[model samples]
Target chain A: MPTTPAPGTVAPAVHLLAGALRRALLEEGGGFRLARVLPGREDSCAGLAAVRVLGADALAPFVVKGLALPAQDAALIRAAVRAHPAPQEPERQVLLWGIRDAALVRGLAVSGVDATGWEGLAPAGSTAHLLRLPWVAMAAELVRVAGAAPPFAEEAVHAQLARSHLDISRGLVRALLRRDLPSAACLTRWLAPAGEQLTTPALDYLEIAGADDPRVSLDTAIARRLTTGTSP
Target chain B: MTRANTPISPQGDHDDAADRSRNVETETDAAAARLAHQVGERALAWLECMRGSFALTAETPDDHVEGQALKSLAELALAAGMVRREAIAGPQCADTAGRLLDFGWRQVGRGDLLYRLQARTPAATYPMEIYAPFAAAGYRHERMDRLAAHLLGLRASRVIEHVPNRRLAVVAAAATIGVTVPDDVAAMIGQTWLGGTPEPWMLDAGNAYGVTHTVFHLTDWGGRPEGLPQRLQDYLHQWLPVWAEVFCETRLWDLLLEMLIVGTCLQRPLFFPAVWERVAAAQRADGMMPNGLTTPPADPHAAWRNHHHPTIVAVVAGTLTLSRAISHATTAGGEA
Candidate 1:
């Protein structure tokens, strides 16, 4: 016959403990659980232990599983989980909502939604840091969707290339879409005459410019052109 | 007829003297014009050659990368010749000299061309003939000389201080060329020699020597007086030996060309004997010198040896012939 802790105190404490553990598990490098519980009444200890165990293993697999969920529902859970850590703060919740809206407009599944949202949530001046995200897949997906849609044009491609750290020129973007080598080589050659213009910002972008197949000679030629300048 | 029979009067003698003076002045003016014309022609030719080489290098693909090397060597030779000719003949042809001077000054001011020349030629191989024109044009040769010395001295000091192991070859070469090391350069070298602590990279003797040799040639050639036989003598006696050792060890074709330039510029007694020995040792059965030194084997396959060997041998032979002529002239009562 174990004495139960007062219902109000026990419920609030358990909720608060659960909340903290959830935040730690979600935010810390891929969630871990507390192995042992602190000494307490059997019921309270059992609740704490259960929450810790469930929170650690449950959160990761649940989020990973949610990746295949319908885009709308997945977005809702991602927003809920992100906002869960600090529900009292309306601004953070609003920020997470804005990112969810952007992801929805782009038609991307917000699988790593919290990480993605957190990346964009820094204050206005921290945009540079936000831009460092490995958004290649998202950008590629966006480009594909944009191609199918009539509104996406060369202007959109140019803007993306300009803003993104992806090493791609306007011509390279077109080449990527077309999967043509001669056109890519023509652009590369035009940019880097005898490898002189290889290091130009346009060319540097072309070097790490992700494509299904990266042209080594063209990239090298571009790099060389940039370094030495009009190689003669 | 009766007046001439009385022996030309004092007025007639005065007229003749006046006519002679006018003729002399006209000849001088014509000579000046001719010299100027010659300078302009040569300068243009050199510029054209440089442009051609640059174009040739640019057109070459990766597999033909060796074309660039040949172009580089040609450009260096052209630049050296242009500078030397302009400096020597510039005063005699002020207009042409002025143009050439402006060009050289501009190039030197940019710093890149000077660095490139230094990279190619040994420090002691600068053409003394160039300084003569500036001196003739009423420019202060000593001040220019001192400025060059200071610039080279500072560069040497930096290399010695920041990079110590390379100091030996550089310092030894500088000493050989009789390059007056400022107090700072000397101190830095001395400190390094006396077991002063060096950076991690400075511990490798080969790298140190190689880097120092580069700096030495650069500062040395870039630092010499425009025109002075004693300076040339210093280069031949002091600098050439260390370079020879480096040359023998490395057998870099460029180094051989540098040796040739030094031989042509100095024509010192000490140089020809050593150079001839190097030449004799370098000559292959097919009359080709190995493109680069083979000992110490930087690569196992002797991959570095290539077409440049024949070119270097030809350059050395030409330089030797030039040196012989200079030696004869100097010995035949021309200023040593």
Candidate 2:
């Protein structure tokens, strides 16, 4: 899920920038500019922070369109990569590895400059249904690049997804019942990509529920695309 | 672009996980039986202590004995009769059932009130509904039965439209009273909210209760499993656990208890020991059920007024699930 400004503080510029990048990815002709994406002298830290939060999705349109990665955009990613330490938390760690790997595939980071292999970090196990929900971020990142960066197609994750379809569906039901839309939307987006083939009544609920929160709107938009195979 | 080629997790595994969910293994059955009995016993101990709450007197400590208490008393008598008939709850529970039932019968004025009510409103269903449990316990009033038979003959009684589960209750309640005049139960079942087996993900608290009570009437409060259709049984097996988890999170303790009781009556006897433990834990030391009240209301009369139904529900859930657990064990032993 894209970040929401934490309540009670002024929403950071990076949060708005990340949302702009997400908006570009979703809206047709929303214009992807190399200059805007490159780390700049002012608020460049915030710019890279925005990309870090949005993860690989920040690079999606460039990667998908086969456009050359600008040298400055590469530097922007490198700066973001250098600034943040690898997280100790499992979900954050998964996010860290996914962002690094997305850069590697797109030629933004050379070997040894940034760590790449995300497979070892993919959440896999009996507790996946409960613990791995955050893995939706991994899927969300991967969805932006579609076929170019294959996170779900990786062997271990695919096997886990096979076993977890029911678990995923069950989690989706609970999330909806609890009125936890962000979770519900995340689970909905991840369902079919994780190999679950079923009607997502939860997505249908989100569509009609009229939630105006931008984060939920983005997640639900992506969810609608994933489940229905419509344009994002 | 690493074009994706790894096959999606096979449809075979998905179906297999579903298959596993439906089958009840022998060991699980034995453990569940023990657990179900424990939950019911603790709940019954509490209800017996608070048996005065199941009163029909015009007034109690603070409030009038109205619809809620009246319904609670009938359900108490119903649960007591079921336990006494099943005799699976052991001597102490059965003895508690016996005393509480005597208390319940006295509350109804030993059927005089029921007879008078039926006479007053021959078109009404509550009098027959309340009287059936008493008759099942051999507390007969010949006049009441005659009144019910006459009511059953009326073209009006047969056609009164109740929402599907209520319709099933009326039909099942008739059977409990030993009247053979039957309505089209299968037709009624077809009309229930659950009969069509609507979308499981859309289930809300109100519809959830509708689903639970429909199952209750189908199984005669868990006395018969064959009465549940294979289609509906399979439907519940697949979805009931998820529904139970949702309700538990919502803290609908009584609804969760009802769903657990429904689980015991399935042809395969679905068991979730964790859920049973949580539900049993929710019962207070003195046998008062929190029902769904997270905190007791400040007014004493309001607290007593709101208290009666879920506690009675606990008794039925306990009796029905414990009885099912025993039968499941018997069947398992026979197979072994």
Query: Evaluated with lDDT, which candidate comes out highest?
Result: 2
Docking quality (DockQ) for each candidate: 0.00, 0.16
Worst 10 residues of 1 chain B by lDDT: B4-13
Fnat per model, in the order shown: 0.00, 0.24
Model 2: per-residue lDDT, tens digit, A166-227? 65566666666676666666566546454343445565667567254554554555555555
lDDT of 1 by residue, A7-98 (tens): 63444344433343334323424332322222245554444433322221212222322323334434333343343332224553343333
Flag regions of model 2 displaced more than 4 Å. A1-4, A7-18, A21-41, A59-79, A88-156, A193-200, A208-211, A230-232, B1-35, B58-65, B180-187, B297-304, B329-336
State how far residue B258 of model 1 sits from its true place (Å): 4.5
**Of the candidates shown, which would achieve the greatest TM-score relative to the real structure?**
2
Candidate 1 lDDT at B12 equals 24
Please give the range of 10 consecutive residues that has the lowest summed lDDT in model 2 chain B: B1-10
Q: Number of clashing pairs, model 1?
A: 21
